[model samples]
Target: MWPLRQMLQPRHVLPIHFDNIIRINILMMQVKYCAGKNIPFFAQNGGSGWAALNLTNGIIIDILPLNKVTFNTDKTQATIGGGVSVAEAMAAGAAAGAFILTGNCDCVGALGAYLGGGYGNLMGAYGFGVDNIISFNLVNAEGELKTVTEASDPDLFWAVRGAGPNFGIVTSAVIKSYPDSNLTAWSTALVFPGEQITDVVKAVEALRPNLKPSQNVFLYLTNNNGPVILVTGFLLHATVEEGKAAFAGLYALNPVFENSGVLPYAQWNAGAASFCLREQRKPGHSVGISQLHPEQWQEIWDRYVEFRNKPGAENSVVIIEIYNLAKGRSIPSSTASWPHRDVNAQAIVIPWYTDASLDNDAIAFAQKVRNIWKSTETKSTTYINFAQGDEGLEAIYGDSLPRLQTLKRKYDPENRFNQWFNIQ
Candidate 1:
């Protein structure tokens, strides 16, 4: 605490290790300084969809020292630092013979992803990442460091769980973990020719009703020379014997390339994260649907083909992540600002262009896909983290839009934390 007090300057410095509570207080003081003086700041981590927002003239704070994950003596729960990545958190939990909910991307910030209704392979079994969180210790707009939990401050806690960045600098959180230390899992990545894209989507949709809470599937469309091809990934938290029935329909598709095996849960969760696009800060847009009929899936495939055929769009890609919602569907919409719970899938468009003249075309292409789905969307919600551009309040927050705005007024009255998707 003494060292941090001496070092708490207004400028960003490389994070230095400090005791947990002391580090939280130091960050609270820094946030308070910024809030009190009306100086805006941005807390940067991964910045997965951060570039689309307006961050003009705000200071950036690096809070990496808070990236610690510790298990309780009895191992029912674990306290995680805000800066920890999925890879770090998963390994930490597995060390204690436990597991926690996290996204597929190993390098994505753990708390950041959880704060946005994190979707992952574990979601089918454990629900979204927010479902595992127990409490959060954050620096609010007032610069006061407060420990928030369902019992301590339900309203702020509800808002913080998924609608983060709208409130403050979350230093750490306590979350429920699963007892799957020895759980063996399976992952399958299958590639199909361009024409067979519909078969893959149909295969997934057909298996949706049979999918256990432990299974997850995602489809990817990208350029194969000139025509669009499909790549599919299937993950099951259970071993092959328990998961075989769930995968029977998928195997019938006869993919061009297939890989499936038994592996540690941690290894499957990590998946081919090396292939995740880390550096290209291109414009992207996303749309969510609970379930799409075969016709709708065909429409999405058709759109992907069109996007790939555009000039300088050779590197563009589309990823449709399927959320079986096995355990995730039972939650109340008010659980967090992320409104859609029954959504069976979400699709995102990443447009990379080499020609400056095609910038508008690229963004329009992404939005057109989103708009096409938006017209038929049963629920007016989009997953917060995967969303881009200026989607309306209803689309991002759903029925909880008004309540979140009110919470924004109560907590961040001046909206000091408005850089990243502003709640107001």
Candidate 2:
């Protein structure tokens, strides 16, 4: 069989703890050793692979052991270690009767997503993962631990919130927690075959401008024979009545399939993480568009149908996330490098391929699919995790790119952290 015997494995792994700041600084100092040994070093936890399109291949540092969430005495905020997954943070905060701003997927590293303008069902309520951050334990390029906060270093703090990896290694972060006003959470998935994609797109467009702050609707389509599924989730609900109302506009389309229910917040978090990516999937190439225009939507549907016929693309998927931009904008625009706060949503094309030969075609087709939606975008902004490589500075960080470049130089002058998205 023509196959790779094994995936590219890390050559070395360095694990650190929350109590051992000295050890982390020592690991930071190891960069000198890496220089002398002529090896590249990189750090990761949870392995979400959202921070960059390319990955570091040598001397990998596994920072997954720093997985603890400790609340302050007043219980106003919770400090999470870099190794904590979304699931762990939610569990720890739930025990303390607090809700932390977290991405819906429980499997992803909490701090990495938080640093990159993390969007979630609660985004309309809490703004963004970056908005709730208070402080951090950052190891700079000089191998020194610096406590970064709004008062101590406002410029660095602002940059790190959305561009953390571009600056240094974040060992841990302190962020605020809140009370969940909605005692219950609800979600419904509506099924529509290829024939009804146009109607579904228009209906969603009609509702997009008027979507409530507590509601999030996503359009999910697989390259397989499955029908397009429009999933709507409600965060502000005590009764099914509110959830039902939130989805009434879409229900008028008379979906062929539907599933609706309520569950605990923690359960919801786990459910969302496993919703689409239930299995360990192959490395995916993805790109995002700021909004979905009607003409672009039709083109996207046509292109997706064509892509579905391609060999490996059959198992791939397209995700249209209708975000609560109105709510996300409540956070100051200057706080981070994520500049697409006013956009309505994102249309992401995820192309997954197994063999190395299929990689180029998958990425090219995925970029084409994204280009259809991008044509309709008034703004060039997109999410960090949703980006495909070659988008350039404006597309990823928008106007904030210049400021980020200065901070990158000031903090990481030699560009040790450029392995991820770089300011250069």
Clashes of 1: 2
| 1-424: candidate 1 lDDT, tens digit per residue | 0101121243444252587777777777777777777777777555455236443444567777778999888888898898887888888877888878788777678888899888887787788888888998888888887889889888998888767888998888899887654656766666777677667777877766666667667767776686555544455555565555567776677777676677776686554553355444357778787664666666767776776687767767777777668587777666766677867678777776555576677777778777776677666567888777477767777777688899999988888888666878
Q: Write the per-residue lDDT of candidate 2 for residues 1-424, one digit (tens) a residue.
A: 0012124455666666456565576667776666456566676777665333333366767778878789987668999988898889888877777778788778778998899888877787778888888899987776667889999999998899888888878889999887655445777767777777777777777777777876788887763254364555554563677777777777888887787788666776654543335332333334455445665666777776676566655666677777566767877788776676766677766654465676566656777876676666665666776665567778788888898888887877777776667886
**Where is model 1 more than 4 Å wrong at Cα?**
1-22, 223-228, 231-237, 240-244, 274-276, 296-299, 309-313, 353-357
Residue 239's lDDT in candidate 2 = 60
TM-scores, one per candidate: 0.89, 0.89
- Winning candidate number (TM-score): 2
Q: Which candidate is the best by lDDT?
A: 1
lDDT of each model, Cα atoms only?
A: 0.72, 0.71
